[model samples]
Target: MSWSITLTVNGEPRRVELDDPRVTLLDLLRERLDLTGSKKGCDRGQCGACTVLLDGRRVNSCLALAISHDGAEVVTIEGLARDGALHPVQAAFIEHDAFQCGYCTPGQIMSAVGLIGEGQAGDDPERVREGMSGNLCRCAAYKGITEAVLEAQRRMGQDGWEEAA
Candidate 1:
């Protein structure tokens, strides 16, 4: 029973045909759309490596079924750039050296973007840490990640970023 789903991906409209009810958004993004930036750290959603923006909110793609997101907007790491320019969050991550092995970078960036987009960027390190605790980096680059997100909030002129939680 194949079903059709239309979703805005990375600001682009995408229509896909899917049949398997068990097919998750992560699988569809990686296997079908070839958007492999989001990693599959833990398929059970324990790790935030599969994080993506669903309607401007952070969600674990691995835990979301493609069929369930029929008309939702999805933003992957590939969609973070515009006209050869990096997003502010991406630039901040690079500038802050927020990643080590880079495996968790995409997720971290996505999560950060969500936090900022939701007007949660703030100066409170503890709040930032608590909010970003879902995304784990095996390389233990947490300090850099926190710094990058905080810096991005500052660069974006986003108020209350210093008090996000």
Candidate 2:
């Protein structure tokens, strides 16, 4: 049975016929929709290469089923820009040199956006590190990534001081 699924992706309405209940959002975005920014690193939720925003929360798209997210709002790396202007996180990544080889950058930026939106980027490098630890970068650009997130938080009027427990 083919089920029709409607979802808002990258601020655009997308409707597709899903024939497999086990097909994940990542596959739908990459294979079906041709949105290939999200990589398939681990494909088992162990790596954050497929991270995306599900209604403003960060989730591993590889573990999220397209059928389960019917009518849901999904944001991928392709949605991180507006009118050719980069999102603050994207700019921060570039300005801070947060990525090398750039395979994990999309997921890293997506996770950072969610963290900042949740008020978790309050100048605490440790917390930022902890929050972003799920997204691994084989290039070992942790310092740049952390700096970019902190810079973005500061730009958003955060105190830039370590968050108090």
TM-score each candidate. Answer: 0.93, 0.93
- Per-residue lDDT value at 21 in model 2: 88
* Candidate 1 Cα errors over 4 Å, as ranges: 158-165
| Total colliding residue pairs, candidate 1 | 8
Stretch of 10 with least lDDT, candidate 2: 156-165
Question: Could you tell me how far off, in angstroms, the CA of residue 89 lies in candidate 2 after the best superposition?
Answer: 0.7
Candidate 1 TM-score to native: 0.93
lDDT, candidate 1, 1-165, per-residue tens: 889999898878899999778889999999989999999998998889999999879999999999999999999999888679788889998998899999999999999988877766477888889889899999999999999988988877853332111
Alpha carbon deviation, residue 2, candidate 1 (Å) = 1.1
RMSD from true fold, candidate 1: 3.7
Report the C-alpha displacement of residue 95, candidate 1, in angstroms.
1.2
Per-residue error at 29 for model 2, in Å?
0.5
Give the clashing pairs for model 2. Answer: none
Steric clash count of candidate 2: 0
For 1-165, candidate 2 gives per-residue lDDT tens digits of 889999898888999999878899999999999999999999999879999999879999999989999999989998887679677788899999999899999999999988987885588999999999899999999999999998877775643432111
